[model samples]
Target: MDDLLAQFVIEAAELTQQAAEDLLALDCEPGNRARLDSAFRAIHTLKGSVGLFDLAPMQGALHSAEDLLDLAIKDNVELDPTRIDPILAVLEWIDRCVQHLQRVGTLPPTAEDEGAKLVLWLASGRAVTPAPSPVAGGTLPQWAAKLFDANPAIHRNGAVALRYTPAPECFFSGDDPISLMAGVPELVFARISTRENWRDPAEFDPFRSNLIFEAISMAKRADIEAIFRLIPDQIAIAHDATTDPSELPAESHETTTRTIRVDLARIDDIVGLVGELLTAKNGMSALVTQAQLLDGGLALSRNVAALQQDIGRLVAQLQRAATDVRMVPLGDTLRRLSRLVREISGQTGKPLQLVVTGGEIEADKTIVDGLYEPLLHIIRNAVDHGIEPEEQRQIAGKPAKGTISVSARQVGHRIELAVGDDGRGIELGHIRSTALARGLISAEAAAALGESDCLELLFAPGFSTSETVSDLSGRGVGMDAVRSSVRRLGGKVTISSAVGTGTTIVLSLPTSFAMSRVILVTVAGEQYGVPMESIAETVRIPASAITQVRSNEAFALRDRTIPILRLGDIVGSGAPGRSEEMLLVLEIGASALGLVVDGIGERFETLLRPPAGLLRAVRGILGTTVLGDGRIIMVLDLEALLA
Candidate 1:
């Protein structure tokens, strides 16, 4: 795709998102003038951008939305929930059009009908259609005022103001835009300007139309439209009523933040390059050690060590910068989900409010993107099953409106994002019944399980409490998918609930999935890595300290008897007989276990690529990382092993 089209996709998506958020906010507080104006400007700007392409349907829909917002802001029309919904629907339609354009290089075939429906919905409040009609003879447009200011000889009174922006490819269509403008009846003055910045002289293409024609005509609006009949979408006609530019309808001017849109794949490539650089940096340490073994190498080794130190510092900075680039604020994702909540609420006829907090907390782009699907499923379930009906809520002494809240916070190198709702919480009895009915859990097992244990069953594949199938929830595949997705991102999912209060699910995820700190250890002469986050500490204990308890081993440390598991035995490698045993105390959630290894080596931060191919089916392995010597070592998933 061309650069302009690609940029339009990105920017159109952003504009629709902003407008959706602003409209949602307006739905709650109709009197918020700032939000109203912001929504108006976003839609207006998006319309202008859409006008530059062959997206006439999108332009028409957005034009109607902008007109509605303008009426609301100027004529003091109350933007209640009724008006906000259609505007949001239009934005959603535009977003879909943008996505289709990105995928197929043009709008979908249904764009015309969809845009028309949305335009009709937006224009339902007024008698006029989506197209621009003749303005009353009292207020001149801003563009017309500028045209008169530039050309002092032009007659301003009762002149029809026209701004014609021919399509870039109009020249190839055998249409002379200049000739069409010359045919305008009683044309008095005209000004031609470059539509955009001129390209490099050598690379410029004369075949592309790059001019915008602004003219004042004594002809009627109908006569001007007849002249530009073939390209009605590219022309705008208004009656020049008043000389004062201030008399025109006011539009909010926003100070835009300078930013650039980058492809996520590019950032991932940069991260991969940084990982390779880290591997090369690690090799320098091995070089320094090898230098010391040669004759008269003491001085050489010292210089090499100093140089390695400098290079190490630089590599660390580069690593940090690369990781920072991969980090993105969760606010955008949360806002998008908030839009989803609004949609689900509308579909279910459930009055709901979404409150988001700590949206500024940053996480890896992968994590943020992966979060949407799981979160969407959760939000659907929340709206469909969790939130009780309005009448039921009233009888239960609860508010008629249900509230769903999503909050995030950072703890060390992990992010704790909790999605909660003020609705009917999951019932333990219902969960047990559903599990039993689906044969997910035995009756005996259900009786022995505690509250948390029963909640965990919710994430079991094909385990759901919905009795009937619908567009939302029903055939299972909700929480289970949530768990799988979170686990794939090196994250954990947990749920807590109060019988009649609400349910809150917390997802603990690594801040960056690319790089991880692992403690290198040797088990049965083969090197392996254990994630540092799961380890409490490393301790040296004598063999005699291990005690047998009912055919199981336990070790005492600081007045606590932790269960012991040999890494060699777990990996099918025979236990190594040693006088002193090295134990890594692992703390995973509420369980603590001691993992005995053959030897513990240096701690290193390296890229932990997810398992692929046959390795993906293997259990108890998180991922693989490359060592300085180019050997691939397996990073053990201690939690998986313990489970």
Candidate 2:
């Protein structure tokens, strides 16, 4: 294997991965032009690159895939969920092949054999066969032999030279450029350069596209033709060895583009700068407060204050920019699920249609990556447990084909993603019985819990409602993994189900690790801080309006009475003033109570950092907040309060 062949193999695998992902999106977004184009291009890219390697099997498979995808893109063939599984199977095969090559210096098993089957499957109904290779025998530059082959020569502007630029992602084919250059014809002079300039040697990858080329008598035309042949925009051949000689028409060459890869360490540098700006903004604020307290205020101090204000604005902008660095579109992980749905539906003989909404939603890159498995689990569960059988659905007055809808929405400082399905909902009694049998709950407790509560118990590990397990989903369970994933992100998951109606699972996660939230209330004759998310609502009651209920003081709210909890008692904050204290109705889960305080207050927002060690173990309070008035208020954690 030569360098170009090695590069081709690596690039082909990547293209297959991309094509599989694109195929998955087609079912969710019917007639999606971008996905269609992407799938076609990925296949074309792989087919073109694989020509350099002697892997005829992989090449044939990619050719078939490219032809099929092209047909769909051009509206020649219908794009349906049925068409995606074979593509995924092929992609998975290619993935395995690459893994084997990584472990051993040879292509895994018979990749071409599997690839050939996939190609034939895609092209079965098409009247036209796949296009013939532009090049054969090797990835020779255009002038050498077949059109697609690398190291092939080209003719451009009447000048010819052997030309080939290894893929930015190459070297997986098990080839070395040093030895590859030695094999090419008319070897005159050779030059090498990677896609990026090396600022640090340690960051450089020796095989990751350090493009090498040797040209001689190298008809300047041959080089130009080779460059123009492999890629229309990437190469050029001129009268002299001048970089980027205007060999092609300026109109077309000007449109050429380049991509750069930056290490994550560089991004962290920007985030660090943002942190410093925040710290500086805080320091300036502290300094200004001291200046105001000084006995004599200098005139120059006022100018310095104005400068500080400008810096404060600059810092705010910097902070927003830094945070934006973490935001990435969610389309990434969700794109390949269509393939999974198609394959599983085939195996189970169930018609599954995946509907996606708000795929354009963007969030922290880390969050998007974390969402893949959770999202997959929900989709799978919906198919297995949420959706009813065809006959059962017809009896329930539903369409024969069940619909599974996945949606993502931005809510406050959080993103809420939901997966819903039209199916026979959870059988509440079965869950209660299962819990009892598992020793997870006593008979009395099971009897006491509501139907919804019993359904929620399915999130426990090793719980499964499916009878006579199937390979698709009845292998123990997966919802527990879903809950665990969301929880690890400091998020929560909730499920709602109605028998013979439908089911919905919602995952709520913060946009970032920590953020600002404040709820204003009075305590100890002064205003205090509480997170707004912690407060369910507030009730105003006059001193004489309150009445006793069940031997305890309670307040009537919308015809429902709630227990009262005095803030002074909970925090030992001196005592409520003689005047009637305002009752703030706090709610979490099934628990709702009122906090009696000195007076009502205005709400505000501020970032709250979790305290260290055991302090974080305190359940009721989330974090402390500093108000505009410089008062420290404790932000209550309503989730903790209820749990």
Query: Each model's TM-score, in the order given?
Result: 0.58, 0.50
**Cα lDDT listed for each candidate:** 0.79, 0.62
> Which stretches of model 2 miss by more than 4 angstroms?
1-269, 272-276, 296-308, 343-349, 394-400, 409-416, 426-499, 508-515, 518-530, 537-559, 563-638
Q: Residue 240, candidate 1: how far off, in angstroms?
A: 19
- How displaced is residue 20 in candidate 2, in Å? 23
Q: Give the alpha carbon lDDT tens digit for every residue of 426-535 in model 2.
A: 77898888888878789999999886567668876777777657676766556777876676465778888888788899989887643454667677766556666656
For model 1, the stretches where C-alpha displacement exceeds 4 angstroms are 1-9, 13-263, 293-299, 346-349, 411-413, 426-471, 478-480, 542-552, 556-561, 576-580
Question: Candidate 1 — worst ten consecutive residues by lDDT sum?
Answer: 249-258
